[model samples]
Target chain A: MLSIKNISKIYKGSNKGISNLSLELHQGDICAFIGANGAGKTTTIKSIVGIHPFDKGEVTLFGTNLQANPAHFKSMIGYSPDTPALYPNMTGKAYLELIASLYEIDEGERNKNLAYLLKELTFETAVHELISSYSHGMKQRLVLISLLMHNPKLIILDEPFVGLDPNATRFLIDEMKSRASEGVIILYSTHVLEVAEKVCNKLVIFHKGEVVVNDTMEHILQKASLDEIFRDVTSDD
Target chain B: MTKLTLLFLFRLQNQLQLANLNSSNKDVRRHAFYTISGYIVAFLMFLGYVLFISIDLNIDNNIQAFFVLISSILFWAFGIWDILSGPDDLIKSKDRDFIFSLPLKTWQAKLLPLFSKYLIHIGLTFIVLMFGYLVTIAYIDHFFLAILFVLVLSLIIPLLSTNVTFLLAWVVRHVLSIIKWRNHVTESIITLGLFVAPLIYLIRSSASVDYKEWFIQASILRYPLNEINSFSFMQHIILLIGITAVTTSLVILLLTAFHHLVSSQNAVQSKKRRTNAIWHTHIPVTALLLKEFKLYFSSLTYVSNTILTPVAMIALNICILVGVIPNLHSFSYDVAGFTITAQHLFTFIMFTCVMLTTTTSCSLSFEGRRIWIMLTAPVSLIKIAASKMAVNILLFLPGIVLTAVVYAAIFQVRMLDLITIVALLFFSLLLISIVGFFINLHFPSYTWNNDMEVVKQSKATIITAIISMITIPAIIAVVYTGNLYLLLLIMGIEIAAIIVLLQKISCNNMMLN
Candidate 1:
C-alpha cells in the first residue's frame, strides 16, 4: 500500500536523520516500526508523509508519487504525529470538519464519520468545547478522530498510546485490527514492546537509522520474545 | 527562603541567558538582535534627554521631581498591565507542575514566581528613575542626602504599585468568580472597561485647558525640591512612610483574604460552549478567512489591540467633521508653477490605521506547532499565504473605504483624485500585508508561551513597524507631490514584489524550525 525507496535525509552538518532507508507495506499489514531513541523512525515517517522533504529517493502511496502530487497523495494517507498539533481555539467538531473539508469529503459521509468517531471515543459532551480546555487524553482522542474521519487507506501514527488511558488503548488496538482486516495498512512506531508484540502482525526493528529486523510476528517469536529481541538488537556494544 | 532564592536566580538566568536560545536558529538570532537593538535605541533616546537636562540645572529640582512622578505613574501603568496578563506567566505555566512537585509550601509556590517575575519589571523602573535622580543629584550641594532621598522614593513607588495591583487583581478575580455569567464574557468586559476607562478620562480632561494646567501644577514634581526646609523635608519623609506603610498593611490583609478566597476550585473555569450553527464557505480561501476570524475574535487581547487603531481613526475623523481639530492641508508648487493642494493628509493618516493591526505579521507564527498541518496538507503554500493576507486586508478594507468616502465628501475631492487616493490606500495595504507576511514566513517564532509575544515583540512585527515608519512618510510624499503616475508606478512595483515574494515562498522548501 505504501513504498519508501532509498530515502536519505541529513541534518545541518554532523547529525544524520535517515540514510538510504527503504520500506514497503502490503495490504492488511499491521507493522510495528520499533526503534531506540533517535533511531530515525520519526524522520522516516515524516519523510513518507511529506512533512519533511528527503534528500534522495521517492515515497509512493498507492502507486502515486508524493512529490508528483503531494496533496492528492496525502489525501489517501492519514498521519497523526507524536504530539497533538492542533488549533487550541477550534472545537473538536470544527477541527474534524476542517480535516474533512481538506480531503474534499462529502457532507453526508463527513457527518456520518464524525458521529461514529465521536460516539466511539465517547466525546459527545466535549465536542462543542474549545480544544484548549481538553485534557491530554482527550486531545489525543480528537486527533485520532480527525485521522479516521476521512477513512484513509493508509494510517500512520507515531506514539499513539502515549497519553491514552488503558480503555482507550484497548479500543485503539481493536480498531487497528479491524481496519487492517478491512485491507487497510497500518504503520505505527512505539516503545512499548508488550503492546506491539500482542497487536502487530509484523515487526520492523530499527537501529542507527537502518532496519535491523523485518519479519512476521511468528518468525520473531520463534527466535525470542519481542521484548528480549528488541533489547538485544538495540542495546549498545 | 533557599528555594525562593534558587527560583529567582533560575528565572533571572532563563530571561537573561543568551545561550539558552540556539545561535544556529535563524529566527531566534534575529529576534534577539532586534530586541537588543530596540533597547539600545530606547537607551540612546533616554541619554539624549539626560544630556538636555544636564545642560540646564536651574530647573534641576523640578526635573528630578518630574522624573520621579513620571516614573511612579509609569510603574503604576506597568503594574496594572502585569496584573492583567502576569498571572499566567508565573502561576499558570507549563512549569507549574514541575515547580509545585518539588518540596515547597503553597505560599512559597505562589510568592516566589510572582516576586521573581516582578523583580525584572521593578528593577527596570528603579534603574531608569534612579539614573535620572543620580544625574540630578551629582550636581547638587547635598549629594548624599539627595541620593538617599532618590533611593527611598524609587523603592516606595514600585512597592506600592506592586501591592496595589495584586490587591486589585485579587478583588477582581474574586468578584468574577462570584458572578453567574461565563468566565470569558466577564473577563472580556473587565478588559474592555480597563482599556476604555483611561481613554474616557483623557477625553473628558482634554476639554478644559484650566483643568490640564491644574493637573500639571498639582504634580509633586513641579514643586521646588532645592528650596526644601527642614520642616518640609521631614513632612515629605513622613508622608512617604505613611503611604508606604498603609499600602503594605492593606496588601498583607488582602493577601490573607485572597489566599483563603482562592482555592483550586476558584481557578478560571471557562464553560462557554459555542452553540451557533457551524458555517462553511464554498471556496477554500473563504474557509481560511473564516478560520482567521474565529482565531482573532476568540482572544480578548487580539480584539482589544486590533480595534484600537480603527477607533482612534474614527475619533479623529469625527473631530475633523465637528470642527474640533481643523483638517490639515498643504500647498506644493510643481516645477511648472502649478500649485497643488494636498488635502489628503487625513487620508494618509487614516490609511495608516492598518499599521496598528499586525495580524499578517503574526499569523504564521500564531500557527505555532500546528504549522505541520499546513506543511503536510495538500493545500498549496501560496494559497495559505494568500489566505492570511486576504483576511488582514479584508479586515481593514471596510474601514479604509468608509473613511475615504468621508474624506471625499468633507474635502469635496474630485472623482479622479478620490479614486487615486483609494487606489493608493489599497495598494499600500496590499504591499504592507505582503511584506509583513513575507517577513513572518522567514522569521517565524513558533515556540511562544504567550500570544502577545508574537503579536507585539516578534522580529517580524518590529520589522513591519519600522518599514511602515518609512513607507507611510514616503507614500504621503508621493500623494503630497500630487504625482498620480508616480503612485501608479509604485503600485505596479508593489504588485510585482508581492508576486515575486509569493512565488519564492511557495516554491522554496526550506527547513522548518
Candidate 2:
C-alpha cells in the first residue's frame, strides 16, 4: 500500500503548488489524477515519489517513510516524469541498463524483461540508437520500458501518454491493467479524461492546487461523464 | 525596429545575461554582480599591463606603427583558435531553426552571425589599439595624425581579421564535409591540436630563440627606426584600401557559403551495430563511475577544458626529464632564511595544475535537464558525489604518480620527503574534489542551452576557480619555510575538517532541487 497524508507543498517565493492533499492506494488499485494545467498534478506526483520534499506531509510506501529511508522508499517505486528528460548522449539500451543497475536488478532478469518489453512496444531496432536520434514517441517508449523493468510495487507516471502513438498508448494501458491485476498499485496524472475514465478504478480531480473530487470511478461517473464533471468542477465561475 | 535588429538585440541580451541583473531573486542579482565585476577587473588589469609595457618600452616616435605590428601579430596568434572553433556557434545555435523560420532575408540571416563575430574581434582590437593610442599621444608631435592613424587601423584590422577567419573556417568545413567523419571526432582532433600546437612551438623555440634579441628586433621602434619613421600617411591609406578590398571580397564569399551550408542537409551517421544485447551488472558506484567516464569523454568541450592542465603537467615533467628545458634544480629562492629549491616550485606547479582539474565542479551541472535521472535513482547523494570524485581522482592519479616518481628520481630525496610530497598531493586532490562537489550542490544550474555555459561559465565552476586561484598562492606562501612535513600535516588536517563540514551540509541539504 502507498499512502500520502496531508501533504502541502508551496514553491518558494510562490503559492503555486498542491495544498493539504491526501490520498491512499492499496494493492491492485489503479488511480487517475486529472487536472487542468498548473493544477498541481505534477507537484503531487513528484512529492509522493520523493522528487520534491513537501512542506508538511508523510509519504509511506509499504510502511517505509520516505523522509526516513528515501533509498528504500524510492527502490520500491518506479517513476517516469512528463517530459522524458533522458541523457541524449546515451544509447536507449545503455539508459535502460543504467536504470537496471540503479535498481539492482539481476542482469539476466533485466535482459529478459527488456527483450519482452522491446518487442511489445515495437522499439527493438531503435533501442541500439542514441537517445538523441529517437523521436518523441520512441523516447516515451524507452522511458516506459525503464519504468517497468524493475517490477516495483508502486508505479507513478506523469503525463506518460503525451507523445505516444495510438498503439503505444494502448500497450501502456494494457500494461498498467496487467500490472495492477498482479497486485501492483499504479497512480498516474493525465489531461486525457476519456482514457483516464476508461482505465482507472479510482479518480481524483484537482482544481487550483486542491482536490475537488476524490472517490471511486464507479461512484463518480453515475451522475455525469468525466468530461462534464471535470469541466463543472474546474470552472472558475 | 527591424526584425534583424530585434533578433540581434535578443541574442545579445541572452548572451550577456542581462535579465539576471534585474532578477527579483537576491542570489541571481548577486551572481550577476560577481560575474560582471570579475570581467571588469580582468579587463582593467589587462589594459594596465599593456600601458605599463608601452611606458617601459619608451618609444619616441613611430609608436603607432610599432604597436600596430605588435597588435597584428597578437591577433593572428590568438585569433586562429577562435575562428577554427567558432563555426559551431554559428551553425549549431539552439535557436537556429527558430530564427531561420522567421520572415527574414537570406542576407540578414547570414549577417547576424558575421556581425557577432565582428563584434568580438572589435573588442580584441580596441584593447590593443587603445594602448597604442595612449603611447602615441604621449610620444609623438603629430598627435592628431597619430589619432587618425590609430582609428583607421583599428576599424580596418578587425574587418580584415574577421573576414580572414571566416574564409579559413569555410575552407575547413568544406574539407570536413568531404571527408564525412563524425562531428565529435573531427572536433576532438581539432581541439587537441589547438592546445598541443602552442606547447610544441614553445618547446621547439625555447632552444633556438634569443629572448632579448628577438624582442628588440621585433619592436620596430628599436630596430629599423628609419623605415618605421618613413611609414607615411599615403602608405597607410594604400594599406587600408587594399585590406578593405580584400575584406569585401571575403565577406561576399562567406555569405554565399553560409547560404549553401544552411541549405544542405546535415548527414546523420548510424552507430556501429552491437552483436549482443546482454548488459553486465555492477555495483551502483561502479556503474555511476563508468557513466561519468563515458560522459567526460563524449564531449569535446569537457575533455579539452578539464584535461589540458593535467596533460601539460605531465608533458612538463617529461620535458624536464628529457633535458628539453633547463633543469629547475639550479633555481632557488630564500624565504625567511629558509632556502626553497626548484623542487618546491615543481610541487607548487603540480598542485596548481591539479587544482584546475576539478571536473566535479561542473559534472553535476553538465547533467542539466537530465539531473532527474540522478535525483530519482535509488542511491544516496553521498554515493553519487563519491562516484564523481572518484572519476576526478582517476583522471589525475596517473599523472600525479608519474610526477612523484620523476621528482624522486631526479632529487634522490629522502624517504620522508617522498612520503610528505605524495601525501600533500593526494590530500590536495581530495580537498579540491570535495569542495567542488559541495559548491556544485549549493549552486547548481540545470537550464543551459549550451554545454559551454555550464562547463565554463556556471556559478559553481567560476566560484571553484576563484577559490583555487586564492588557495593555491596562499598555501604556497604560508608554507614558504620549505618544511615538507609541515605542509603535509596542514593539508591533511584541512581535508579532514572539510569532510566533516560537508557531512553537516549534506545532512541539511540532501535534494538538489
Candidate 3:
C-alpha cells in the first residue's frame, strides 16, 4: 500500500503549491490524478517519489517511511517525469543498462526484460543509436522501458502519454492493467480525461492545490463525464 | 523593432539569463545576484592582472610594442581555438527550426548568432585593449593618439577574428562531412591536437630557442604594432578599411553557404544494428563512474578546460627530466630568509595542477536538467557524490604518479623525504576533490543553456577556483615549514570531517531546485 498523509509543499517565495493533499493506493489499484495546468499534480507525484520534499506530511510505502529509509523507499518506486530529460551522449542501450544497474537487477533478468520491452515498444533497432538522434516518441518509450525493467512495487508516471503514438499508448494501458493485476500499485497524472475515465479504477481530481474529489472512478463518472466533472469542480478557482 | 534586432535581443537575454535576475522570487533573484557578482569579480581580477603585466613590461624596458604584439597574438590564437573546438552556433543552434520558421529573411537569422559571438569577443577585447591604452599613454604620453589607436584596434580586431573563425569553421565542417563517423572522429582529433600542440611548442621552444626573442621577431603583429606606434594616421585608416572590406566579403560568403550547411546537417546516415550485443552490469557506483567518464570526454569544452592543466604538469615534468628546462636539483631561491630549491618549485607546480584540474566543480551542474535521474534513483547521494569525485581522482592519479616517479628519480632524495612528498600530494588531491564536490552541492545550476555557462561561469566553478588558488599557496607555505608530517595529519583529519559533514548535508538536502 502507498499512503500520503496531509502532505503540503509550497514553493519558496510563491503561494502556488499543493496544500494538505492526501491520497492512498492499495495493492492492485490504478489511480488517475486529473487536473488543469498548475493544479499541483506533478508536485504531489514528485513528493511521493522523494524527488521533492513535503513541508508537513508523511509518505510511506508498505509501512516504510520515506524520511527514515529513503533508499529502501525509493527502491520500491519507479518514476517517469512529464518530459523525458535524458543524457544525449548516451546510447539508448547504455542508458537502460545504467538504470538496470542502479536498480540492482540481475544481468540475465535485465537483458530479458530489455529485449521484451524494446520489441513491444517498437524501439528495438533504434536502441543502438545515440539518444540525441531519437524522436520525442522514442525517448518517451525509452523512459517507459527503464521504469518497467526494474519491476518496482509502485509505478508513477507524469504525463506519460503526451508524445506516445496510439499503439504505444495502448501498450502502456495494457501493461499497467497487467501489472496492477499482479499487485503493483500504479499512479499517473494526465489531462486526457477520456483515457483516464476508461482505464483507472480510482480517480483523484485536484483543484487549486487541494483535492476536491477522491473516490472510485465509477462513482465519479456515474454523475457526469470527466470533462464536465473536472470543469464543475475547478470552475470557482 | 526590426526582426534582426529582436533576434539579437532574444539571444542576448538567453545567454545572460536576464529574466532570472529580474525574477519575482527572492531566492532566484539572490542566486542570480551572487552568480553575476562572481563573474564581475573574476573579470576585474583578469583586468588587474593584465594591467600589472603591462606595467611590469614598461618597467623592464618600455616595450609597449611588445605588449601589443603579445596581445594580438593571444587574440588570434583564441580566435583559431574557438573555431577548432566546436561548430558555429549560427549554423548549428538547437532552436534552428523554430527561428527559421518565423517570418524572417535568411540573412537576418544568420546574422543574429554571429552578432552574439561578436558581443562576447568585443567585451573580452575591450579589457585587453584598455590595458594597451594605458601602456600607450605611459609610453607616448599622448591621450588622443592612444584613444585613436584603441578605438581602431577594437573595431578591426573582433571583426577580423570573427571572419577568420567563420571561414575556418566552414572549411573544417566541409572536410568533416566526407568522413564516416564524423562526430566521434572530429571530437577525438580536435581534443588530441589541443592537448599535443602546446606540449610540442613548449618542448621545442625550451630545448632550442630563446622564446621571448623568437616570439617578438617572428610575430605577424610586429609590423602592425610598429606602424600604430609611429602614429601613421592615414596608414591606420587604410588598414581598418582593408580589414572591414575583407570581413564584409567573408560574411557574404558565409551567408550564401548557410543554407547548404543546414540542409547537409539534416541528412541522416543509417547506423548498423547491434542485435546480439551482450549486456554487462556492475555495482551502482562503478556504473555511475563509467557514466561520469563518458560525460567528461564527450564534450570538447569539458575535456579541454579541465585536462589542460594536468597535461601541462606532465609536460613540465618531462621537460625537467630530459634537461630541456632548468635542473631543479641544483637550483635554489632565497625567499625572505628561507632557501627554496627547484624541487620545492616542482612540488608546488604539481600540487597547483592537481588543484586546478578538478572536474568535480562542474560535474554536478553539467548534468543540467537530467539531474532528475540521479535524484530519483535508489542510490544514496553520497554514492553519487563519490562517483563524481572518483572520476576526478582517476583523472589526476596517473599524472600524480608520473610526477612522483619523476620527482624521485630527479632528486634522488632519502626515502623519508620522498614519502612525505607523496603523502602530501595524495592528501591534497583528496582534499580538493571533496571540497569541490561539497561546494558544487550548494551552488548547483541545472538551467544552463550551454556547457560553457556551467563549466566556466557558474558560481560553483568560480568559488572552487578561488578556494583552490588560496589553498595552493597555503599548502606550499606549510610544506616550507619543514613539518610535512604535521600538514599531512591535519589534511587527513580535515578530509574526514568534511566527508562526515558532506554525508549529513547530502542526506538532508537531496532535492535540487
Candidate 1 runs further than 4 Å off = A13-16, B17-73, B76-87, B90-94, B138-141, B157-224, B227-269, B272-283, B298-307, B319-345, B509-513
Q: Give the runs in model 2 whose Cα sits over 4 Å from its true position.
A: B22-30, B59-87, B141-145, B152-270, B273-275, B331-341, B505-509
lDDT of 1 by residue, B1-513 (tens): 686687778766555434444577555665666676676786677666655654443343344344434543445456655544433344354466766787888666655655665576667666766666666665455666666666666666666666655555555556776674424334544544554355356545664533323333333333345634367665876786687678766655544345444433233454645564452424556566667677766554444445556556656666666666543454343536645443554665766786545778888888877877777666766777888888777767666766676667678777887787777677778878888888888878787766666776778888888888877777776777667798787778778987888788888553362
lDDT of candidate model 2 versus the reference: 0.74
Interface RMSD of 1: 2.9
Candidate 3, residues A1-237, lDDT tens digits: the string is 999999999998899889998889999999999998999999999899887888999999999999888889888998999989899888898898899889999877887888899899988878888888888889999999999998889999999999999999999999999999999999999999988988899999998899999999989889998899999999985
Could you tell me which 10 consecutive residues in candidate 1 chain A have the lowest summed lDDT?
Answer: A9-18
Task: Check candidate 3 and list the clashing pairs.
Answer: none
TM-score of chain B of 1: 0.77
Model 3 chain A: worst 10 consecutive residues (lDDT sum): A106-115
* Winner by lDDT between candidate 3 and candidate 1: 3
* Per-model TM values vs. the true structure: 0.85, 0.88, 0.90
Pick the winner on TM-score between candidates 1 and 2: 2
Which lDDT tens digits does candidate 1 get at residues A57-114?
A: 9989889898887778888888888988788878877776666666777777777877
- lDDT per residue as tens, model 3, B113-217: 667777777777777787666655546555676676666666566777667555655554455655644453354345455433543465456544434444444
Task: Report the alpha-carbon TM-score of model 1 versus the true structure.
Answer: 0.85
lDDT of 3 at B472: 85
